[model samples]
Target chain A: MSVLFFELAMTAYLVVAVLFMVYLAGRSETLTRACQVGTVVGFLFHSLALGQQWIAGGGFPVTNQFEAASFFSWTLVLVFLVIDVRYKSHVLGAFVVPLAFLSVLSAAFLRGNVQTIDPGLRGLGLTLHTSLILLGATAFCLSFAAGIMYLIQMRLLKSKHFNALYHHLPPLNACDWLIGRGVLVGFPLTTLGILSGAVGAKFVWGSYWDFSPKQNLSALIWAYYLVMLVGRYTLGIRAKRAAYMAVLGFVAVALSFVGLDALMGETRHF
Target chain B: MNLIVVGLSHKTAPVEVRERLAFKATQLGEVCRQVTDQSAADEVMILSTCNRVEVYAVAPNVDDGFATVSAFLSRCADGMDVKALGPHLYHYPGNDAIGHMFRVASSLDSMVLGEPQILGQFKDAFEAALNAKSTGMVLNKIAKKAISVAKRVRTETKIAENAVSISYAAVELARKVFADLHHQRVMLLGAGEMAELALRHLISAGVREVVLSTRTTENAHKLAEALCAEGGPPVRVVPFADYAAILPEVDIVLCSTGAPDYVIGPKQVSAALRARGHRPMFLIDISVPRNIDPATAHVGDAYVYDIDDLQSVVEANLEERQAEARKAMVIIDEEVDTTARWIRSLEVVPTITALKGHAEAIARGEVERVLNRLPNLGEKERKLIEGLGPAIINKLLHNPLSSLRKEAQERGGRDMVETTRKLFALPDEGAAGDAPAGGDDE
Candidate 1:
């Protein structure tokens, strides 16, 4: 469809993301619910607009950086919605929305015009890798948010300043449990994403192990969370400790996905 | 007149000291008799609860009554002077005492404020005094009025409606945040009554998992069994030394132990948080000596509610209940005044009796003399004169009886009744017969 319409929808998602973050900080359930509604609405429009672009291109819309990025962000929101249904915590939406919104916005700004889908890049492995990574990233973002909330709550308790804001946050135990589960789900999917990316690399570049920065960084993120989970189960590391580690792992994952991708200059080196 | 409560509560006196002065159900009669015999109190009642022992009485000479009760207490306390316990005793007289009784009955003065047991205990004491026939008119009025006031307070206010105890309040706070306890896991640090009671509330609120950690294994097992029976998830006992081992599993931590210092601190909590990856933890420190150090709460993402924090919630709840209680007090006051007025109307019996007696006497004397003078008159005519004497007395007393009743409804009607009785030279209640004699027969 029209680029302007898609950009406007993406902007609406951006505003919703910022609003939800504020809601999380303010601990306003009403605003959070509104954010959730806004997100669902924005995603519906984003999907419709993306579908139009796919029809115009005459294939799967994974041709350029813009289409791939938009698709990745779309997958993230879809994954976040599924998790939100399961966990029923508006808290996850607080983090996932920002990341998804930012990626969509990035796609809008970076890709000014919709172009033809590259026939060579349109493979099953690439689709699987991108979808897995998008979902994993969404779940990891939730863990990251939970970890941050947990740390902030812990500090408030430690300072002996039991104010209204302090009580609004979820308990450390709850945060830890949620983040652990989130990490449990996200970690494997991220590993799969890396594996499938390797498979997709062989399909495109004729190499299974290219040792790219994205690959190396994704492995590091996986290793970080793996240690966090193992430490909790075997050595009796608690929810609080697990949450901190998950947060650290998510940061690593983000660096590998977007931060490293940006540094690598539009996939030319890869 | 001054009112004094020369007694001890759970805080001031030990159980031994309290038991020594305790008024048992059987001894209540004897105690009432002894108190009345020793003092000029027209009204006396003893309120003896497990946590407190108090005697409420009304006297014309407040000082003398206090002195008499103090002397009685001093004598009963053996060689221990009443001065030893004088500071603990609170003295409020007349209006203040009335207010105190109102507050106490309303559960405002209770150690665990808003408990309903005290009001029932108060009622029992009142009933005991009534059975012993020790309560005077004023004391009877006050006791009954206090009960009605307490009823109003309980009914109108939500004071006694919720969990008011510190442990229970902490659990309530957690529930408010979480909404559902059935999926939550709770770790209890001690076998304290307060902590256990809190756990019981949590269990009832749908907490599925309960972990008990105490210094004693026996206590842990016992608590585990009790919790299981109370519908809590299968309670597991964690060793006191294994705080870290169980810390990860529990969603909520309730720390109330007899430790001299902090057992759970920031270092351990922080270590746990880091190991578990910044997970959320809810911690409640209810121990007086503070089992959990204040610093431990700072280890990022842990929400802590201490005793002082919980107290404010309780205080706010109490203030709300108290405001409602004040409204109820007005209702009680009206009820008391109406009851008192009815009691005061009893004094009118002698006046009514005297008026009837005077009218009857005049009718009888005049009729008997006239009957003798008309000895030759027919039996029917003599009977007619006798009947006329009865009619004359009834007609004469009707207006006055109605006026006396109207006066009885007025303030100081007791004085008016006395004046009317004296004008007719009526005897006091004892000489005139029982105050309510033959009134119930019809």
Candidate 2:
């Protein structure tokens, strides 16, 4: 049942992505409305899939690579829907929906035998650690999308292209605001996630600071966002530079979450 | 019924001629009523704007309608007659007229393609016609359909999305940099006609404040007073030497001065960006020798556009509007076909009804004559004979009636209606006079 819902959600996201592309090209209100409806429908099916998996596995569904990718995409879509409604910025979906779709597509390919959670790892601290970190990652993904838009818009302004892409994009200030908002919201959540993981690490491994690959990488991701936040608020490093930083920070986060776990065979995160 | 449009637009008439022929808003109703009364038109609408003056009407005969409307316009002109206005007038009949109305409403026929004012003028014209009682079922339906088509084009295409002039281009660029200009400040360096025009555009865009600076303090104070008198955001005059100190607080800088060398350069702009915490700044240099340094554009978050650059932007935007106009034309074409089909169907309705009525009358008369001769026949037998005549008539007319309806939805449906009427020798009921029951008003 979980697999069925996941497939259904993936199909909806694919449709939503295609509709957003057409909406960007044509700029028709009807197409925008269709994209919105498709996004909402996909989000509902994704939630159902995650809920089914959690009930079946008797824990949150972020244990394996497949479940982690699926959970990340679900949170990304959740954040996108919130921003979309709050700002009425449906144009942002053109950049973000495809990313979400790719995330789910990778999850589908990484699907393997479902594994039940270990009894020792089933606690509130572990759940908080996983959920907060995934949610923070989702927020950073939003910043990545905003940064890409900001760079494209800035180039158009600089080069005086004023092409269709330039006309369709939000203002440079709006893009910068999105980048700031993502980091502002994601930084604290990530800090809390890392702290919870530290406390949970002591209970599971009898150590508060192990310097494991995952622990080191998580701290690295946290510190990268910390610099971005501080630079934006105090040091006055913003606009183009901030956009570049947001994009690079997301790259680090993605590497820490996926590449480190896959390449380093001894990571205790598995 | 035939739909016809007659008059001249910027494409066909000079401004002098258009102005002379244009009707006042207060006179639109009276003029529409005059056309309907003096001509063969059953309905009339007059759209009079600075760019175009056109008459939309429904008439029984296109030729008569065209001639009468032409004569009416010639007489309405201030000092022109039929011969003087003849070359300027254009008349479109049938579906061409409907297509022309859709194009005009959608701004495809505008002097500035994709301009927004034409649609509002069109709606006002229709309203005037409605007030004058000069519009009937056909005009009402066509006008409403045109309005909706205009709205559809606006939403589906980016025709009106860009700035097509220099001053507006500056505003458009400023909007691209800042999310909202309502909180931003504008600094006007020096004073010139184009500079003031751009300043007015920015003010209307909701800039919070304006600071004027010039080489001469008296000129600056005079300009500041003039701008303040217009009742917008507060205007302050800063000395020419101190303008650099005010750069950090300004988001948009407009420079148009007679100075030979560059006034604002890369160094000053970079320093300002630093002081403003790297906020974006838009610099527009409209002077001939370029008052702002071009190298400032290389500074982070600083956009420098000279006069030539602004002109190029306008040209590019115009080209974009043209591309969007082509898309709008496609939408207009589809709507024209749909509206033409609806009108065709309307044309065939009366003919179909008349044909059926004519066949039924013949069948009833023949049945009555046969019944009179067979008086000894039983009542049930008489009823069977009566039913047989009507049944044969229904069977014989079914194919032709259904085909007439099918043909009415096509391009050449009017010919089919005429042929059907002639074959049946039915009375020619003017299609315009026979308004179908439940004819919608709008």
Per-candidate RMSD vs. true structure? 13.9, 5.1
lDDT tens readout by residue for model 1, A1-270: 547657766877888888875775652356866777887887887888789877987756665667777876787777677767776766667666787777887777658654434557666776677777767776777778778876776665556455445645666566767777777888788789878878887878899886666667667777877777677777555555665676777777666755775677544311
Task: Find the 10 residues in a row with the least total lDDT in model 1 chain A.
Answer: A261-270
Tell me the tens digit of each residue's lDDT in model 2 across A9-102. 9999999999888877753557888888999999999999999999987878887668888999988888888888998888899888898899
Candidate 1, B101-218: lDDT as tens digits? 7777877677766788999888888888889998865677677778877777777655675455676777766754455687788889987787777777787788778888999878
DockQ, each predicted model: 0.11, 0.64
Interface RMSD of 2: 1.0
lDDT of 2: 0.88
Candidate 1 chain B weakest lDDT stretch, 10 residues:
B433-442
lDDT value, residue B148 of candidate 1: 75
Model 1 residue B141 distance off true place after TM-score fit, in angstroms: 35
Tens digits of per-residue lDDT, candidate 2, B1-442, equal: 7899998999999998998998999999999999999988999999999999999999989999999999999999979999999999999998899999999999999989999999999999999999999998889999999999999999989899889889899998999889789989999998878988999999999999999999998998998888788889999889999999999999999999999999999999999999988888999998988899888999989988998889999998899789889988899989998888878777777877777778888999999999999999998999999998879988999899778877877754778888887887888876434636433211
Q: Provide chain B's TM-score, model 1.
A: 0.67
Give Cα-based local distance difference scores for all models.
0.71, 0.88
